[model samples]
Target: MNGVVPHIVQYQGSKRNLAPQILQYMPRKFNRLIEPFAGMAAITIAVAKQNRAKKYIVNDLNEPLIRILNEAIETPDLLIDSYSKVWNEQFLYPEGSVAHFYKVREDFNKGNKCAANMLYLLARCVKGSVRYSSNGMFNQSPDKRRNGTSPKNVASNVSRISSFLKGHVEFMSKDYREVLQIAKPGDIIYMDPPYQGVCTKRDSRYFSGIVFSEFVEAIEKLNQKGIDYIISYDGSCGEKQYGTDLPEHLGLQKILLKAGFSSQSILLGKKELTYEALYISRNLQDSIHFQNTQLSIFDSL
Candidate 1:
């Protein structure tokens, strides 16, 4: 778990906390692991750390994030240099200093993956969120206390990842459905798409507000192909049906996972909200069957 720290630094919607549990359910053996919404690459990184999957294909529609990850994977030295320079200037600017933030963002947005990784650490929210404006720009304002902490050494982080990630990591910005083309049988796909039930303060729509029906259609395609995949979505409303009667009409099973807190309440506003992480799969019945049988055994015992 020590190696899990640096990997956690890069992700905005990281599943690091849930990784151990998720890993428990993963197949005992697999050829490759696919994460289409590789926000922080948390799950994939953990899988890589365990040497569970040889090849990893991680994709996201977020271009800057992808570029940042590529550099973190390919070149560490350059990223370290750039990040060091930025780390020195932390909190020197005023609050609401979008100008300074823009300069920082520009430097991070450069093609260097290492630099991008560093910027991701330096600029992300107090909680490592990458929520942006509706136009898809990084809108996370600067936090005053973001300083004082030891900035992560990109080189060291890269070295850790280099062992398992070099030449094996594939990064891209594309539609999540595109993952289907690259996946083959025996490939385990763990998708963490933008949750339909929640939105950041920025009011930004992630993943184009992925339509429930379209997502179902894509899952159906994966089902027909016998692809092994797990999808994570919103389920906070106690299995509240989504997008017309499709969930019941089409039989999309909802598995509720308590996501973090709501950003609304005054005093506890920043406190984590108990959201849900719904899991949908191609073989919905088999997945449900596994859940039911497991529950039955637990109940009987």
Candidate 2:
């Protein structure tokens, strides 16, 4: 295994730790690996590195995330330059430097190749949390730490990944469900969508109930078409809290997984805690198939 690990931002329900486990349940071979709600894309990157699929499609509704991936994959040189600029101006900026931060965020939002540079800066900000304004602008305050990591000159590795993605990978910023029309049978789709939880006032504008419903619909369609897929989300509550009302309608099996990491939150004088990762699958047949494969492999040894 290549010991190259990219330091990426960890979102609330990131699947960085859950990928290995969930991957074991999917079809062993497929045409492409698709991630609609690719946040930090922990699973997407893991799957790509595993090199099991012929094609890779990583997408997200967040423009900044997409921009970062695009810059890393398509233009490593520009990404390096952008990171250098942020490092050079690191000390000149002040805490909550609205002007400087806004300019960086604006460039990213405007599809600047340098957007990836701003992502690192913003992630290192106040909470390791990305908070944006109502108009879709990053408003997070900067952290005092400077000379943040640049992942060395792994441009060759980045280029290798980009080379594999020239025409193999597709990036999109639309609602994931809408962009799922291209999914077909024998494809492995990994969806890491926003969990059913609260968002701070800063980044609250981006969440959508409608998008969630449509995502369920897309999963159902994929399942019906015999497309192989695995979905990971937050499962802090019991099985009943799997939002039974949602996936049950699709005849999916809600699998509670102790995935990723969790943190406590106290709000409104009440403490409600939950796990960071949760998953739901197609049905009994999929589970049986997975079990049979595992048993067969064990027996072979």
Candidate 3:
């Protein structure tokens, strides 16, 4: 392992906290690492710290987010400078930080499309959410915290991510299906798509529409092609058992991950324990054995 995982932008539904546990389930050896629904690319970033794969490919339907990630990897100095300017100014008037956040968000919506602006919005926006309006404009409000993330921390993270991504990373702004189509036999694809029962209609506007049946069909295709994959989706949040039901005949193994209390739940005045299910493909299952009781996958239920 590479000691510590590099930090990336904040994202709603990000698997940042669960990444270490998720990594334990991955195959020890793989030709490439691919993420189809790369929100914040949390898994990829965490995996890259260990230099797990020879090559890395990540894709997201959100173009602006992808652009920022690409910029972070390819041009760290510039991204750092841009973010520093915004953070320095905003941190001064913590009480009036909302005005500064809106200005940066406005620039991002007007097609300025830079990593600094995107980072600013992600750090300042409520719940680290990348929500959009029907007209396709950034609409998330300020978080109202003391201030956004510090410039020094952002710069350090940017530098670390850039160093980690040096020559083996490929960022794509495309539909998940398009990226999934490129996966071959020796590759391991980790998917963290939007939660089915959790993400409401308004929240769904942040990315492209996900037709549940079509998504299952895509997984079926990956299975037929002998691709190894680990999929993370909703299991239970608080008292609610939320998630999509998979076809029993698919033969996928289920791993119930205890994800602790969710930040979203806390925001809503509820202290709900979040449980995520990791549905692992058969091909990759034999190679990994979980010694820790907490990380074991159940054979039934």
Candidate 4:
């Protein structure tokens, strides 16, 4: 491990905290690392710190988000400058901050595509949730919390993320199935698709509907081709289960990791612990060995 963990942009349903544990099951060496549904790319950025792959590909159905990531990778300095200017000039007015935020959102909706605008919205929006209206406009309201990350912090974060993505990473805006189809035998694909039964309304604005049956079929194809893969999805959040159940016949090895209360749970006034499911392909199961099975917290399914 390089011991350098880059800070990822704030995003909803981010697996930032679980990234280290997720990395444990990855192949020691691979020709490429592929992430479909790369929300803020928390896992991808974390894995890049380890430099385990010769190349990396991050794809998301959210076109604007992917554009921002590509811009960060290619011209971080410019993005930093633009974001800094907006922060210093617009965010200074505490009273007008909310109105200014909406103005920026309106501009963004009017086809002014830029990383700075997207970053600002993500930072200031409610709980880092990205949602759009039926008319294809950014619809999430401004977070009442302090004006988003400061210029210095955002610039530093962009620089760090850019440095990590300097040469090996390629960002793409495509369907998860299309991106996964390119994975060869030596490549490892990490999938964090929108959870079934969750985000039904929010997901429709960004991409086509995700049918769980079709998603499972894609992974089965990868299994047939001998490609290694891992997936993150809903398990149990406290007493309530938020994700759809996996089919028993898929034969996936399930490992559960403790997670914090989700944003939705917090809103519902529920303060219970959550768990994330890590479904591993059978072929890659032996790659990760649990030496102290008795002491480990992971549960096998």
| Residue runs of model 4 more than 4 Å from their true location after superposition | 1-4, 92-95, 198-208, 261-271, 289-301
In candidate 2, which residue pairs clash? 233-278, 236-275
lDDT of 4: 0.77
TM-score of 1: 0.75
Per-residue C-alpha lDDT of model 1 across residues 1-301, encoded as one tens digit per residue: 4746356254456777667656655665678998888876878877888888888998887666676667667775665566556555544666434445556665544533343444544454445556556665555655545442334655666667766687888888888888767888878888876665442323453534566567778777777787777666654322343323225534454444544444543355445334444454545345435543221112322
Over 87-142, each residue of candidate 4 has an lDDT whose tens digit, in order, gives: 66565666588888888888899998677888888888887888877666788999
Best by lDDT, which number? 3
Error of 4 at 285 (Å): 0.6
TM-score of each: 0.75, 0.75, 0.89, 0.89
What TM-score does model 2 achieve against the real structure?
0.75
Candidate 4, clashing residue pairs? none
Please give the CA lDDT of all the candidate structures. 0.61, 0.58, 0.79, 0.77
Task: Tell me the tens digit of each residue's lDDT in model 3 across 1-301.
Answer: 2466767666777888888889888866678999988877888888877778889998988877787788788888887788888777775755567787887788888998777788888887887887877778888889986566777877788788888776888889888889999999889999987777534454534566576777789989998998989999768776677766677666687777887878888999987776788888878875565444445334222
For residues 225-255, write the lDDT of model 2, one tens digit per residue.
7776666654543223533335555665445
What stretches of model 2 exceed 4 Å from their correct place? 1-12, 92-113, 145-147, 151-167, 198-212, 237-245, 265-280, 283-288, 292-301
